[model samples]
Target: MLQIESTFDVQGDFGDSGLGKLLDMFRDMSDHDEDPGRFVVEKVIEKIPAPLRWAAEPFEAVLGAEVNDQLDALVPGAGDEIQAIAGALSDRARKFAIRSVLDVGLDAKGRKTGTHRIETIIQVFKEARLELPATELGDKLAPATRIPITLGAGEFEISEHRLKFPAGTMLSRALPRLVIPGVLGKVIESAALIARWFACADTAAKVAEKLDDPRAGAIAMTACASASKSISDQIEERLAKIDEEGRLRLEGSADEEGEGTYPAGGWRGAFRIDKEVEASIDPQRNTFSTQEQMATQ
Candidate 1:
């Protein structure tokens, strides 16, 4: 068996980059209160790299006007229902801020030991709920039913690191079957509803596989939208900082290691891909893979 270990540091801005442009457009829409309609989102979609287009295309369907039009025809006030869900989610997301901590314990031998655990904590000072109209789904669901948006603080540990596999490898296997948390899960439920409305049974089924029960309304989703913008801004800011020289060190065995630096070539310069890892291992087998990102503006 060949044991491999690596460490890398890379930083760069989206300067005139497609991703930067995409993030900027989203930020502008959220900041300026402009509607992120299908047409505008399509323009944003164009800014996504070719490799990411497929993953992003589904969202277009999820957020597009055509889908809303379709849903309104099927569920009458479905559009309002979605909006209410999104708003409810946004309220929940806003109620708690994410805090992270790194707890490290050293062994007496002075060798790095202990869990070296890092965790992201969502601390909720108070729990809150948003009410949604149940008549949209039918009388069985409660209209006055308060969907819990924020809950007791939960801690998620960041212990495992994944190596960057090729773009589609991980996503293709994970997305269709992945079950996500309540925040986005509610949105997925709405998406599944929309997909079924279009008679896109396959899309609906796939979306259904990712759904969580008892959806949160628009307010919760609104918070997710806000969080999405925050995430976009953070990514853009980090990418913008990649300058001059970037470094990578790879160790294939206890005795063998390679270290190198590549010029970020400044912004918008052609990026060079220095390495590629090909493994034929089964997708079910968990393994670690790491790759450095090099991008041109």
Candidate 2:
């Protein structure tokens, strides 16, 4: 299984009280269309103290406006106040950001369903900002427990558990058909290779500048040589197979003279009867066969 982990702190004055409110609000809103007021309520809930919830209600009303202004200042042409609120919440509360785990599973039809595990630690800091007490924010995240969550086409269950302090709590779920492991690995490998290529190129340029030698560029150039050759060989091999298939199709045609003739060259002399034979024969049968094989595999 592939695991992705990210950490962020929540910002603003509300703290854990605010975070809990926001999570509850989000859980409720997830089923409906976007609402800026609901989003603001969530953010405000993260910043204020529990005892101050009554005092914070009024501020929550203006949250949509405040969040909009912040977003407009940061991103031009950014519309949709609710979306802006969500984005700002994500940015300001990096510390409060939920750590989500998505478990991917595959079905017989090759479709993917994802189960999600979301968790975060809510901490209360001293007034001096020197130290704080950490606690699991909402629900405990457990490894094996599956919650009743409905993902698009696939059905999945999620279970959450709280962990002992000093040990971060974990929320995990079993998701079905989120993605094929093989495809995901290939994407990750491709991205890593691209990043490596760029790093090698940058290093080569730096070395060239320091050495003042034209040959220094070859250091980075050499790293890419093998990758380029591998890609080229794969393309050439595919093309060769395609060409052979085309030739075989042409050979199978009933008219001997018509076979292997260019479509543009007419059937007589420069327009020979054979040359005029249409080469636009549909390859749907072969294409469909190939597709079926791939799907089965």
Candidate 1 lDDT tens digits, 1-297: 111112121222334433333334334433322222343344434444454444556666454465456555665655444444333332322222211112222245533221211122122211332222212223221122111111112311122222211111111121222223433344344322122223233323322333321222222233334434544454334233221111111111111122321211111111211232111212222122222311211
Off by over 4 Å in 2: 1-38, 79-297
Please, what is the whole-model Cα lDDT of each candidate in the order they appear? Answer: 0.28, 0.29
Model 2 vs. true fold: TM: 0.20
Of the candidates shown, which would achieve the greatest lDDT relative to the real structure? 2
Quickly count the clashes in candidate 1.
Answer: 32
Tens-digit lDDT track of model 2 for 163-198: 111111110010011112433323223422122112
Q: Could you tell me how far off, in angstroms, the CA of residue 6 lies in candidate 2 after the best superposition?
A: 34
Question: What is the alpha-carbon lDDT of model 1 when measured against the actual structure?
Answer: 0.28
TM-score, per-candidate, Cα-based? 0.24, 0.20
Model 2 accuracy (lDDT, Cα): 0.29
**Stretches of model 1 off by over 4 angstroms after superposition:** 1-69, 80-101, 110-114, 121-187, 190-297
